[model samples]
Target: MLKSDKLERLELYKDRNTQVFLNKFLSEEISELEPVYDPKVGYHYPIVEAIVGSVQDAEAFLNRLYNAGILERRLYDKIIYCPKCGSANVSVRYCCAYCKSFDIQRSALIEHVKCGYMDVEENYKKGNKLVCPKCHEELKKPDVDYRRAGTWCTCKDCKKSFDIPVVAHFCRDCHTAFTFEDAVIKDVYAYTLREDAKEEAARGWVIIAPIRDFLLENGFEVESPAFLKGKSGANHMFDIVAYEGK
Candidate 1:
């Protein structure tokens, strides 16, 4: 599509929260471009617009869009040619993307097979040439050109690419099993930690009775075993160790 058409479609994003995000991008309040959320999931469309803005709006927007598969990315306006087909008709590309060059001479670069960085680096710095498995092009060893700064390895064989990357966020507590986004929701409930013991909770955290009482009043089935006796200066004995529904 034409650039005018693309910008116009962005204008039609239904959620006002999204509009605010986009407006911020236009105004430079945000450097990385990201979709606020998907209207289908994060919230119902035509959000009347927050009269008094809340952080929940932003949080919900990101969580919902992340669940909805709306991509978050850094946006740029610059010339981009496909490193794959060598076509200049590229519609989308990431910052510092290493594209496979179709040229026979540029194939000397080793593009990491996975993320596709072709800008080449120390991973294979010992070598000066690569055989493009795709186009069968061999490129000369890249010499540092300060103007050409991107983290990508050019693969001579596939003429493919890989990214020079960094791990964005990691929780030492959560371990590698979960993503940075996964812990975002649990963070919302963090204040529950301040409550004293003798409460039921999730993920091994302490939960209190008043919060449980509210849930019960709201029609939640808050069950506890009647037999466990509370001992002074000991962990609150849970009537039920963990939930296993009837």
Candidate 2:
């Protein structure tokens, strides 16, 4: 742990003027900690911990890094194993749980398409599935062979253009089946903030948009941070400037 070094550094910052030093240290260290963001934090805990200072500081730093565009975060599919079998073997049936059959499917052209019934004219393409309703089946998807068919299907389940073959994963849990892409994933560029990650401390946690809105809502003239020559001659921008008020 870098506790000793940090505490020693803290000692140097004991004087009232230490705030400036702290700012410098934070900015400098962030750049050095550049390896923590990718492929999950499971790999480099030491480096992340040292750069982050403390757990709380690490979290705050991560958030600031996100805003600065040094790193990005996005949602992904909630992949889990079937509790009953503990086997990775799985498929969305009807729109529910991973079933062992293929009596249901969803066509992804318009929107929802799981129900076997309903004849809607769809100029759909191949490889689309929707969640099933009745048995709570997860929509079935097409394989390479199915995509080659170039068939368009309008599903009555979701009223979307998705093509299905048979029963997909049926949710034995909630009985609600559907197709989805895990959310957006955060993408961070190493070079984006590498040089100045440490310098970002002055910007603080609050994002510019919200802070700007706060100023507007409360009726204050606000503008960009005044640029000043930092300790190392780095030109810097403050997070904000607002009129003093109640």
Candidate 3:
């Protein structure tokens, strides 16, 4: 379709409302939609999840409602993604920068007040005696002689030192490795009905109930749940149909 033609055809109700998500949302007392995540199910976002329980093409149904402007999405949650394929099935782990090993331990760094020097606490160990690395002085009192500066992570494999270990994401599904820069951060969203859509849904069959009754009182035959064939040789069903002089 042409861009201008598509833009002009973007009219409301051009497509029929399936009311799949809307019916489920309206049925709920609390319409506040949120994303619920489980390790087994990955991610479940309200109405879409509810409708997809019995159907296979849940994404298609959601896309339809979204395209019709009946469903509005709100930022809900976030997940880590694989840089290669943009898959969310990824695992995060801290590794050593030098050897890229997972075997790493963290320890506090001690600072000598006398010499104004800071090093790892393990460096000050001298045969069960705390010694200052800088001045090489025997530390008697901990508070007076030295204090803890910060913590440092050391790689057991390569014996390399670092303030913070390198964080890398591993794609479990595709078996891919990506650095923090390469790792993609994606936002998940919760779906809700638009205000106009909610009003339309709220009206529902109640709107047609009065019209059907009026037609019945004025001597007209009403056929509800009527099935008819369309010009395209497709079966069309109507919730209500009225016939005059029948």
Candidate 4:
């Protein structure tokens, strides 16, 4: 078996910097942590991903941590994903609605106010002479007989013209095409320590380690994580308990 291979059961340790960060939040919650941007991954990772090493299932782990009152979530950036496969690998493309071809070109259109003839700018150009295509009138000045109307695109493949192209998304990974309505939008979140969890860490294990060592140095017996029954018939774990002069 590979040493790195995950098993069904294994011992895990907390109270590392990752957990201590939760404990240290008693002072104030950390915020404004910059994201880690990876060009290859094509996504900006949450700051906690940069801090934690063993974050394989990032979404699940962060959600579980949030449920455990260890971390709180703050609204972060948002991103769009492929609705079909939920992949972030997507691109926006403008294509002709009739033929759905990307081979389209846009050009200006000129309208002759005198004859009420509207055509492309190229049709009105006759060897540097702006001649009206309808009445064959030679144009002299702007707004006199001709005026620039609008612009449109024509599909070179199908020869179909349109005023507006349809918006679309192409999934580079799955090779599937979809419209904007089929796209999935997801919001990412930043994390901070919860107020209640921070308050518990004040008299919790955050300072218990040093206190335990101090008691042992003074010729006293100290039991860390001391378990005792309360009057309510419930067991409670205390951070430290010391006894002396036995």
Q: Give me the candidate number with maximum TM-score.
A: 3
User: What lDDT tens digits, residue by residue, belong to model 4 across residues 4-40?
Assistant: 2111101111245445345334544554333354333
The sequence of per-residue lDDT tens digits that candidate 3 reaches over residues 2-55 is: 332222222322223344446666777447556666553346554455656522
For each predicted model, how many residue pairs clash, with residues at least 3 apart or on different chains?
32, 53, 0, 0
Top candidate (lDDT) = 3
Q: Which window of ten consecutive residues has the lowest lDDT sum in model 1? A: 189-198
lDDT of 1 at 207: 33
Residue range 1-246, candidate 1, lDDT tens digits: 233232223222334554454444344454443223331222222221342255455456544433333323232222222232323232221221233233222213345443344443343444665443444444344342112244444445455555442112222322222222332221111011111111111212123334455656666665443234456644443433333334
Cα lDDT, model 4, residue 107: 75
The 10-residue segment of model 3 with minimum total lDDT is 4-13
TM-score of each: 0.18, 0.23, 0.56, 0.51
lDDT of 4 at 117: 90
Cα lDDT for residue 30, candidate 3: 44
lDDT winner between 3 and 4, please give it.
3
- Candidate 4 residue 192 C-alpha distance from true site, Å: 2.7
TM-score ranking, high to low: 3, 4, 2, 1
